[model samples]
Target: MAQIAVFFLFLAVIQASVALKCKVCDDTDGSCSKLRDETCPAGASDREAACLIHIYKDATTKKEMTEKKCVNRFKNTGKYDCIENPNNQQIKCYTCVEDFCNEKNSATKLGLFGIVSLVLSILVSKIL
Candidate 1:
């Protein structure tokens, strides 16, 4: 029972290391409209709509990249209308800024190392 509890606790701690947020698009002045017509014109079907994007950092190096829905968002143009497209009116894979993982913060690093040491000590004890 204690081992199971410790394993779950470790998982929870690791899960807390992950963070997410909308990476501000560099093109179109952070506007979905301009991005639709400029940066990724080919990918943009409608000139208006909230373009949702999924982003994350590389597991090994913590580099930011678009994993899915890499669409662009228009500026604060207040134009929330949908344009026409041959296939569908959904916007995906637009322009976006790179998102970086902040897990390397001093506090986070300390906590991570502490947890790792604790786990290692527990394993060593069990082995001995």
Candidate 2:
């Protein structure tokens, strides 16, 4: 029983460590509806990868450019944030995890649910 639990934990770790899939696009306008999905590659110093939604607006013309791509994980936390650039002009970056998680109605629900579901199933099997 202990070994089974350990095996499940190991599998969960492996699943979490897999490459992240992000929506990739660079649009002149504000449309990002039809974009490509790409799996993030390994980063320098073995850092984790994440989905990046970078938006830059021209202060003078007010022209906006939206770019979605996979980037080397900026922070260790998997939470999404839309932070403004201090030095740049009207540039914001939103980062997230999970496949195609750069959309507007995206959720950070990743492999945690699967890991919990599998562990619960294992517990039920042992009980029965």
Candidate 3:
């Protein structure tokens, strides 16, 4: 029983840690495209806006994933305007998976629950 309790505690800690690191990928509104040109003037290119690019590991490994930059070409200008790149392709804005979080919500919930439980236990024991 003690072992089970310890295991649960460990699992909870891990879950909380994961939650604290969770971050939603936001690659919209030309954010990821900025990585390509950063200063391309309007009408310089004609590429569709790419918000998020997936990085595959070893061409076959599904366990590992990363983000890349999505570029949008400007129409009539024949130029490219670079924006934010989530894929870490650009040397200036490369991001590793370790830099992001995956389970922030869970971690917050766990923390709140832990605090509330501790307070309640203390209050009940005092009343008893």
Per-residue alpha-carbon lDDT of candidate 2 for residues 52-118, written as tens digits (9 for 90 to 100): 8777775556667577878776455654455554543656676777766775534464656456856
Write one digit per residue (lDDT tens) for candidate 1, span 48-125. Answer: 222234334434444444322223344454242333334432333333322221111111122344456567657655
lDDT of candidate 1 vs native?
0.36
Candidate 2 segments exceeding 4 Å error:
1-3, 26-30, 60-64, 74-91, 105-107, 112-128
Which of the two, 1 or 3, has more lDDT? 1
TM-score-wise, the better of 2 and 3 is: 2
Best by lDDT: 2
Q: How does candidate 1 fare on TM-score?
A: 0.21
Task: Name model 3 segments beyond 4 Å from true.
Answer: 1-21, 28-110
The root-mean-square deviation over C-alpha atoms between each candidate and the true structure, in angstroms, is 15.5, 4.3, 17.1
Worst 10 residues of 3 by lDDT: 98-107
Give one digit per residue, the lDDT tens place, for model 3 in 85-111. Answer: 344343222221121212221112234
